[model samples]
Every structure is written in structure tokens, then in C-alpha cells.
Target: MTQTLEVTQAAEVTQAAEVTQAVERPLQTAKPALGRGLLLLMSVATGLSVAGNYFAQPLLDLMGRELRLSTTMAALIVTAAQVGYALGLMLLVPLGDLVERRRLAVSLFGATAAFLVLTALAPNGSILLLGTALTALTSVAAQVVVPYAVTLAAPEQRGRVVGTVMTGLLLGALLARTASGALSELGGWRTVYWVNAVLMIVVAVLLRRHLPKLHTPAGLRYPALLRSTFALFRTEPLLRWRAGIAALSLASFNVLWTAVTFLLAGTYGWSEGAIGLFGLVGVAGALSTLAAGRLADRGFVQWLTGAGTALLALSWLAVGAGGASMWWLIGGVLVLNVAQSSLLNANQNVIYALRPEIRNRLNSAFMTAFFAGGATGSALTSIVWVSAGWTGVSVLGGSLATGTFVLWVLERVRTHA
Candidate 1:
């Protein structure tokens, strides 16, 4: 009886060792190196996720006419979307550190798809505004995907990876206007949302299948996670400076985008399709993202910021001239797009370097400030457009650009000192 008992005990110990090895195997294996194909998929997903917020830009006029909204209310739709996005940056994005990133991203993408349908089916202006806000709020999945991509890349290549993904994001944002206008022309403004809703679902499925699983539990609970995100602004001066610059750059960007539809549709007498096609002009700016990323990787970030800010200020001059000459406006837009893209890439490169472990939190803080500036610009433009017309809008955009330049100068002085 004693011999039999000893054999059984030995067999049980052997099974336990096998179970331990099974658990340890995955932890010991290295993750596959990030590939160009996977990187492109991420970029495409990022772009499509952000596109929903922008679809309304070109469709504002048609939406207003159909919904019987005043000009101010029509413009507020843009503000609502920006505000919602800001909220998401603060509230939802930080959760990336607390949960499985792939699941967080996929869930947000699916939610955005549902919200797009809600926006498309709105029966009145109020519903439309709500839907737009919800859609924008969830569309921050784009931001989540960005840090996820960064986490997968080697430290040496983080800047280039960010730039590549950002290129897709910028394209989605710029092209949404074009797609909205063309789709609206073919069907109606509602069609733009419906079509995008479908696209969101498709991207969600792709992301679910391909996004490698990564869960780095930030150890902090939900409330602490949020507190730490806010704390980053206080502790990291570089984050503060970059966040401020991000705000002003995006504000200037939105100031043009929000009011330009009014300028083009009313002043130039352009059709929806024509105004949409004009967004293609900014595609040239998106192309600069990859090059800017490469430059940042090489340690030319400060020079990039200075040059970009100066170019931004100069672009407004051309944008102001666009009031009479389309050629001047086109030139201005090209410069503005390049400046904005380059500055954004530089800002992110520095911040991402500061804290690799909490990139999502860093991104949240920076983007919240960024979109808040966008919201402010959209709101200010609506008011300025009413009182001073296109000239007022031009002055607003130029002032914001100048402020950004001045801020960059201050940053240089302070850092060098």
C-alpha cells in the first residue's frame, strides 16, 4: 500500500511541472517584429477611425438646409465634434493602459460604427448634434491605435512609425471632406455617414484579426490612472510645451476648415463636389508626414518646429489673399498643411520619448489640449465669420498661427537657457 501511494504522488508532481511550463512558455517568447504590412494596416485603421469626425465639414450647408438650422447652429456641429473628441481623449483613451489595447481599440471602433449610423439617421438638428458628438467621442479610437502602434515599434523607429500612422490619420481627416461632398452629391449628406458607418465595421473586423494582443496593466486603478494622466502635465515641462503647441496648431487648422466652407460655397460659388475636391490640395501636406518623421528620428526636431511655425505664419498670408485669388489660397493651404504635419510629428516624437510605459496617458493629455484648441477655434470662427466675414476668419487664423510661432520661440529660449 505504501509503494502504490508513492508512485501516485510522483505522477501528480510530474503533471504539475508540465502545467507550469505551459503557463511560462508564452511569457518567455518574444513578440514578432512589427512588419511594414502590419504597420500599413494600423495606419489605414487610424485614418478610417478619424474620418468620421470630419465627414460633417463639407456637408454642413446641406445638413443645415435640410434640418433648418441657423448658420451658427450649423457651425456648432463642428464644435460639438471637437468637444466630444476632447472628452474622449481625456476619459476613454487612458483606459488603454488599464485594459487590453486590442480589445479597447476594437470596442471603440465598433462603437464608432454604431454612432455613425445614429448620426446618419438623425431626425432633427438636436439629434444630429448629439449624434455628431457621440460619433466624434468614440472616433478617438484613432488616437488609441496610435500609441498601440508606438508600443509595438522599436525605440529607434518610434518616430517614423508615428509619422506613418499619422499620415493615414491626416489623409482620412482631409479626405473625409471630399468623400462627404461627393457622396452627398450622389445621394445626400446622410449617405456620407451611412457609408462611413459601414467602413468602420470593416476596419473594426480587420483590426480585431490583426492587432497583436498586448496588455500592460498600469497597476493603477481607474481613478489613479486618470490622476496620473493629469499629473503628467504638471511634471513634464516638455509635455506642457508640446501640448500647448499642439493646441494652437490644431486651432489654426480648424479655424480655416470650419469657415472655408462658408467662403468657398458663398464667395467662390463652388458646388459641394468642388469644395470637397479642394481638400485634395491638403493631401500634399499629408505626404510630408513621413519625411518629417524621418527628420525627427535624426534629431532635427527643434529646427523642424521653428521652420514649421514660421511657415504656418506665412501660410496665413496666402490664405488671406485667397479671398480674391484661388491660386494664392491653394499655395497657402499647401504651406499650412506641411507646417501642421511637421510640427505635429515633432511634438509627438518628443513626448513619446518622455514616457514609453504611459504613452496612452501622454497622448491623452496632449490630444485633449489639442482638440480643445480645435473646439475653441471652431467656436471663435463662427462668431468671427458672422461679424467680420472672411477677413475676420483670416485674421483669427493668422493670429493663432503667430501665437504658435511665439510659443515655439519661447520654448527654444527656455530650453536653451
Candidate 2:
């Protein structure tokens, strides 16, 4: 009887050990934590890379003059870049899983740097468009780095790290406008691209030397990998829900920014410089990104989503009313900025949790949808502003915000039920 009891106890202990290892193996295989300095480097690299797409936005008029193109033709410079970026997001970002991410990202940086210089050297409008397209396509380098940040983090801290990197991306985009405007005014529009090219070179060197080479497990062939993205969307209910929220929230945010320029200039008689400066004010709100991440780390996604959607909706009230007062406008803009960052953090928190191995594809799908929303909102703003005027545009933006709030409510009710 004693011998039988000892054998049973040994079996039970062995079973427990196997269970523990099963639970721990995934975490153990995840990439190790990145140091603070390297994380910061990743953030900086991401920011500079994304900024490549926006450099031409404020320089269109100057380029038009130099290239002997009409205003309509010059505007396509920004459009071409944006289209290339969207294509790269879908086509290239997924490659992160199939290759050494640091190698891929650095090579893109070098390629984009060359394209930026090519853009600056272009003698005609056709060449200029070609260079711009190529530059923005490769600038998706930043998107690849995002999943690299996630893979470097522990499962528990993934949200926090993602937030930090996103904050850098947002800030860089905001500053890009301001810096481009200032530089184009002081030097020439071409100077902006040249300076950005040099920065890209520096980032490439830094990444090659300092960024860790994260291991890539064997992956599906490129075509199968691309096809799998669609399968993920079909299967992942949470991905669908989070993606819908991202699209709606981003649309609301873009509607406000796009239409507000018309309001500031027409209603308030603000100068172009003063209007450009509003991008700086939006920076104050981007600070919410890190806080949003921490909230996600603490498992407050649903609550954050509910509250963020509400805040975004309410901010439109101030936005709609701000036709009367500049202070009201500024307050609404700040709230709008904070709410967007929070909602973005919340959405990313959910999607990043869904699949660890396919993170790049997940981010690509989410970001691509998010960009579509922005494009739709931009198009809508043009029509709404022209047809309905200020009141009409505000109502449209407010509707988009309210739609998000409604989506959150439905999600909560469904979960509880």
C-alpha cells in the first residue's frame, strides 16, 4: 500500500510540471524585453520614417511654382505618396514575419533615403511624382518596426510598448507639418526633402548598429501569407469589432481636422501660419497615448473604449459650438486629440492580443482600414463643407463620433448577453 501511494504521488508531480512548462513555453519563446534606450531608438526611427509621407503636404504651392505645374497637378504629389503608403501597408508590412525585421527595415530606410534625394533632384513634375511615390512606399518601414516593438515586449507589457511607439509616430506626423512649413518658408521646398533624406540615412545607420535582429520563424509563402490576412478577418470576431471602431473613430477625428481648417480661416479670419500652429496644440493631446496604453495593460480596454467614444462625441459639441469662441474651439480640439489617441490605443490593445505570431499582418489590416476611414472622411469633408457649410460639416463629424459611441454600447450589451 505504501509503495502504490508513492508511485501515484510521483505521477501527479510529473503532470504538474508538464502543465507548467506548457503554459510558460510561449512566453519564454517571445523576444526578450528591449532596453529603454533601444526602445527610444525604435520610437525615433518610427517617427522619422512615417514623417516621410507628410513632407510634401505643406510644400505643394512652392513645388507648383518650381515645376511649372498647375495647383491641381501639384496636389497629386501628396495623393501619390498616400496611395503608395496604403499599398505598402498591405503588401510590404506582412513581410516582417518572413524576414529578419531589422534587415528589412534598414534596407527600406536606405531605399527611401535615396528616393527622397531623387525627389529633391527632380527637374519635372513627372519625375517628382515618381520619386514621391517610391519614397512613401518605402516609408512603411515604420509600420514594420511597430510589430518589432511588440515582439520585443513581454505579453503583459505589449500594450505599453505599443503605445510608446505610437506616440512617437503621432508626434512625428504633427511636427512634420510644422517643420515642413517653416523650412519651406526659410529655405526652399526641396530643402525639406534633402534634410529628411539625411535624417533617414542617420536612422538607417542607427538601426543597423543598435536594433536587435529579431528571429523570424518560417512563414507561409508570400501569396499564401497575403491570402491568410483575409482568413484572419473572416475568423477573428474581436478583430472585426476593433477594426470597425478604429475606422469610425479615425473618420470622426479626420473630419474634425479637415473641416476645422476651413472654419479657422473663414470664420475666424486666421492666417495660414496660425492655422498651421494648431498642429502644435494637438501635440499636447498626443501625450494621452502612453496613458491609454497603461490603461490597456491594466485590462481596462472596454471601459476605455466606452469612455473614449463618449468623450469624442462630447468634444464635437464643443467643436460645433466653438463657431462663437476661439477658446471653445481649442478646448474641443484638445479633447478630440486625446480621445482619438485613447481610442487608438484601446483598439490596438485588442488587436495585438489576438495573434502574437501574425502581428505584422494584423497591424497592416488594422492600419489599412484606419487609413481608408481617413480618406473617406477627407472626401466627405469636401462635400459637406461645400454643400452644408460650417453647421453641416460639424453635424457630419458629430454623426461619425456618435456612431462610434453606439458601436461601443452594442459591443458591451452583446458581451454581457
Q: Give the lDDT of residue 189 in candidate 1.
A: 92
Superposition TM-score, candidate 1 onto the true structure:
0.87
For 1-417, candidate 2 gives per-residue lDDT tens digits of: 999999999999999787566534543654564878888988888888888788887678789888898887898888898899989898988888677778899999999999999999999999999999999899999999888888778778877898899888898888998898998887898888899999999989988998776655434898988887767779887777777888888888889888888988999898888888888888966788899889888989888898899999999888888888889888998999999899998888888877776788888888888888888888899999999987887898889988889988887777688
Which stretch of 10 consecutive residues in model 1 shows the poorest summed lDDT?
A: 22-31
- State each model's C-alpha RMSD to the native: 7.6, 5.1
